[model samples]
Target: MTPSDDDRTHGGLETVTGAGCDGRDACCRLAAGVDRRRFVQGLAAGAGLLAWRAPRATVAGPFAADDAIDHFVPADKKLAADWVAGLFARGERTWYAGDDLATIGMPVGGVAAGQVYLTGDGRLVYWDVFNSNHNTGYGAVNYQAGRKPTDVVSEGTFTAATAVDQGAAIQVTVHGRTVARTLDGRGFARVRFCGEYPVGRVEYADDALPVAVALEAYSPFIPLCAADSSLPATVLKYTLKNGGDAAAQVTIGAWLQNAVLNDAGPELAGQAERRNRVVQEDRFTAVVGSARPLETAQEKRREPIVIADFEGDGYGQWRVEGEAFGDGPVEGTLEHQQAVSGYQGRRLVNSFQGGDDPQGKLVSPEFVIERPWIGFLIGGGGFADKTCVNLVIDGKPVRTATGKNAELLEVRNWDVAELAGKRARIEIVDAQSGPWGHVNVDQIELRDDPKTDAAIPLRRRRDFGTMAVAVLGGDASAAASIPDGDALEELFAALRGEPVASAEKPLGENLRGAVGRTIELQPGAEATVTFVVAWHMPHNYRENRWVGNYYGKRLASAVDVAAYVAKNFDRLDAETYAWLETYYDS
Candidate 1:
């Protein structure tokens, strides 16, 4: 009789002579039904020392199904063979499509890159693979009432009904109607998912659409092939068969998010340093996502000319309004405020006089711009134009910048080369009256060159490595879309057959966005579209220590990993299929 699905067994043998197990005692235990002397002699004659077989149903224990209490069964309880076989003959288990059980999908990423799950309905979800936390649950921490930790440790799960439109997705346009292969919105009527470790298949069927689509997602897992098995990539192969009679224009699109530095923090909301660009190297075409550090120059030039030192005992030439700024430039930090730094001298503008309830604006005497750059130290709330320093020229603010919710001031430089010799004024406005509704300023200067030691914010760091998604063996045109609100909604517009105006220039930067690739097929034809997702997060953090990943030693970036997978797709695909065939035959 053939072995059932749960009847597979694995065994191995190793030398255990040093563990106080001489050949005599082990042989006697194995030779219970045979002669002890013959068994010991056979061991010396190069016979197998250890062997194991699948457990027989005669020795199986009882199966329990109770919800209120524990279902633990004793080891000595015996069940009949027919009863055990009947459990296997019931049917194959499957996870249905819904928002409640959406997190129970199959993992499709590499070993240490974290988890990226492909749900049963073909939508990619649960993207916790990035270094920052995403979906890992939370636990209680014991702490004093006023000493609670304020740092974010987790981002919680994304399995709600509203999150169904988030992450990567596939859309197929048949004739003029578009159908997202997910269980959300106007989804397919029937969906089936079957997952064997390292290989998963999702089949989609609907009466409204005239095509049948099946997706096979996996990472290479060939036995004894450690190098090929440990790749930091997942291959998504889509097979589509058109069942329509007449010729039909079928458009298939795959979209992915620029999830690098995901969950970093809320401070990175509108930074332009987050980028997604399309690249073509050799035969591989991919869209790489990364967070780049803000550019800085290290050159030394002329010394800065002081604009406003704010060192006098009172407001001499600068005019102050409202109750925010006191009668004069106050000293250091105010009452009920954090210790402030990075300012020169003993006097500076401190707007938190009474509290955050005060609002005011300080206007500087109009001065002709002689230098090419205007530099200043600023700190306070990040309310954009509400709590910021402005460079006003011709009665209009030409440049504006705000603090990053910080107490320590950082140098901010503005390139005012175009405004040189133009009459300009400095405005320190604190028109907000809410939490952190104050502003701080000091040591304003006009310089020939920009400041080189301006501290780069944490959200703009280049710590996050690159991640890429490539369409293997195809020169399909790709586009990157920056979202005004929802990233998936912007991506779906392209999948719904909308013309992308930026398709020719596939390079753009945004905090959150999507990249898409499109291709068309005729009716009654069969086609396979393959996509590979790869990442190169080299650094690993644990126990307050930083280390390097082994995969990073060979692959420098995600584009490199994708290119390697594209070059070896034939060999790796063949070996993976071969292993699966051998296992099913056994």
Candidate 2:
């Protein structure tokens, strides 16, 4: 059987021989049945090599014919042609400049770990490692706009804006003059990029700058070793050569954004409490960034009055209909369902007994709404009224809510203050079928506390993760600040060799910011500045599944990852370069 076009493009098998036939016999039969020249043409076309045509020649091997041109090609010419084509493809991996730059973006993260693209112009872009599907244009905006805590379920729109600019850039100062153009290929006379799989290199040349700058970016990638290869970090090495005759003093500064928790919904984008601070641990210095919860006044609360804990062996009083709710409350996640969380005790109301095909409803006994709030843990389908929990008062639903299409239950509170002292019954409905067609509910309570409550500590409402930028050598001075108008200008000034004081506090909250490092160098000498961007995002969710991350288990935080990488940078870089050397030699 011939493989499909998609299979060919993705390196799938080319052909499968019929049963009971040896490969050589099938090949011989195929060669005998078709004209030699036509077969070659067909083979080329099938291999997606239509641009290159085979030379005119008779079939050359035991099946050679004398009907065509006298030219005789080798029997293994096809294999040789494939090898030559591969070499040509590899040779095409040289520097890409100008128009070719647009095509130079490649993923540089570990397998199954999140990744950021290294663009041709030497900037890191398209950060998708956050475990959430972010919008293509604005990396800060999540595609699922209503997935965040406190967000109302709604469709999201794409904005014509770029991702949260990390300001991941480098600037050089020669003598006392600051170069206007950064190393990201803007305004440079000669800017070229070359991507060799895991490694990407960009070269910048300009007459205005006294030194030529080259930047190599990559994450740790070791063949046959998934553990070492999958570290959540990107290593950037900058090499500067002073080619000027006179002694020229140079200052090199690098900057990066505190992009932790940047993947927020559009409504909450401006409310993220991003924080950045500089930390010195052991011999390494790093700028650590994280997202803190927004500050709000704590409300006075009273103990919740338990309405239904769902801890009993069966539904004692609730009336259950259809096969979806089964005979009683489920012990946990149902068969074939993702892990269920945020539920109290061992059992919860799960309407997925026979998968999503079954539809049913669980009606609670009538109870008095004595408190100002009715809190419950809910998850699953976001079908609104079709698949939701409703507070039925006077035979009508006074309050209703559906899950946000998640398996992880979240605490939701209905403000029943106006309906206080009224009689109501809870109805958990699952009328929809197919994907996310079921519903999960647990720990319904009547409480004066308007906020949602849970038996176990639920996932934090605010995104809390850390990303750090560490300078390899201890000689460089580092600083981190919120990227306000004046702060950015100060950073640029520092990059231009201006004397600036490092932030005394070195800590900022509730703001977007950048971290920078500065270094000084003298002419007639070559120096290399290396920066490591490490992230520790332990929490990752797909739909409602909490997948977590591989690197999160190994390192406690981004600082730890940065420190580990810094301590082993020599070995890692050496092994990577050795592999590159072997590849080129082969």
Candidate 3:
């Protein structure tokens, strides 16, 4: 039963040869070339039911065919899931919010109306504008570079002007902010600029040279609707006109402090293992946040059931890539106190570090996805710790877990009920270069049920929606916040290992902080800095958290957010496209 080429490739859902068969036909096709008894035995074996004496159907939940919400549940869930999965696969973090701000329709999720901070140079220094259903904190706030990288603009001057709606976009104006005499008694060079919101961009110019400098700073994470929730990726783009005769050498850098801000204070900023570690990847510079505990009040004890403690695997339960028997330039080794210290116990550890060239993977055999949670305990650090553990179901990456804690093992888990009743695979990938690049794994667990405890975090609840936006910044040795322009300059230099001539003080004396990066642009060359923030929703917002009168208000707010997205979807789509058309080609 071979399928036609068109039938197999036409629709996005590629069905197996007999997948489209009717119920009776499916049974008949499945039974073909085999006896009924053998087929039944095979099904039993596949479902891990060979030990059971009798067959039984798994009962999941209640259902009402006539109820409107119940009727729409399956369709809505599938639509949302498919949409999210599709966007994630394409490396897109926002919905159909066109490419640019010229987009005609109202944008849905990206940046909302709230308090926005503008740098003296008109750059969007910080913004706390998104709408959050939760009551505690405001939506999301990110400072440019998490701190200032004044070295990027030290040679020139830029001042903030005015913010206005320029018919097609929201433009924040900036002009020359500094005036000083050099040895020859001439004013410092100045540039005119306009920073566009909703577009996540800034455009500036310096036109006195044979090769002029035309800079356009932008981030593609700008959306017409609410952010993607799971991965709120924002990339600030800078295009420099290095087309001039003389090549200009510039340093691009950022100081990052990626901390989860709830209502918690200094603790969140204190426990950072790698405070603004400069991460240089092949394509982009990024700062990863790790060891960020969900609970600031009291540490939650994690006692996950161990699935693979590497105690003994004589049967080869794991698949090793890049080499055989865990030995090579790129391989996973069964280590017993080799590079690091003691293994979790006498059990051998699955240590992975494929040299700087080849990427290594340690994959597990198939397992049932009926469990409510899946996670692993991992610890590693050094020149590179980009190793990531993935949850793959039916050949798709449903969730990912990573570790930046070079010192201690941390518990990382992800919900997997979406793939319940299915078979899934666990894959650990280490496809990066640099020192301390290896990852150590001990207990790999698939939790059977949620933990029962008093004062559970809102995130642990099966129904409450949870999302996070991580802002990456430069290398800050400690938690620091800056306000004045002069201090911002010293902070960048300090991050770059240069000595500060004057006052070296904490940017802010509180718990708030950020991490960042820097980009050096030749006269005509351009660079874009981006980050992705993510969210998870189970349609349990009103079901889990809100119960009484509070639930009513929350439900109303949810409706408003949903309505806003729906109403502006079409308009934002057009507006985004229009804005993209101008910048897309450039």
Global lDDT of each model? 0.62, 0.64, 0.35
lDDT for each residue of candidate 2 in 448-473, tens digit (9 for 90 to 100) = 65443333222342234777777777
Residue 71 alpha-carbon offset, candidate 2, angstroms: 14
Report the alpha-carbon TM-score of model 1 versus the true structure.
Answer: 0.52
Point out the higher-scoring one by TM-score: 1 or 3.
1
lDDT tens string, model 1, 469-575?
77777545455544556544555664344433232111123433234455565667878778887877766654325566667788888888898899999998889
Q: What TM-score should be assigned to candidate 2?
A: 0.57
Per-residue lDDT, model 2, residue 581, is 63
Cα lDDT for residue 560, candidate 3: 31
Regarding lDDT, does 1 or 3 come out ahead?
A: 1
Highest TM-score scorer: 2
TM-score to native of every candidate shown: 0.52, 0.57, 0.29
Report the number of clashing residue pairs per model. Answer: 0, 0, 75
RMSD score of candidate 2 (Å): 11.8
- Model 2, 212: alpha-carbon shift in Å? 1.7
lDDT of 3 at 64: 48
State the displacement of the C-alpha of residue 111, model 2, in Å, after optimal TM-score superposition. Answer: 2.3
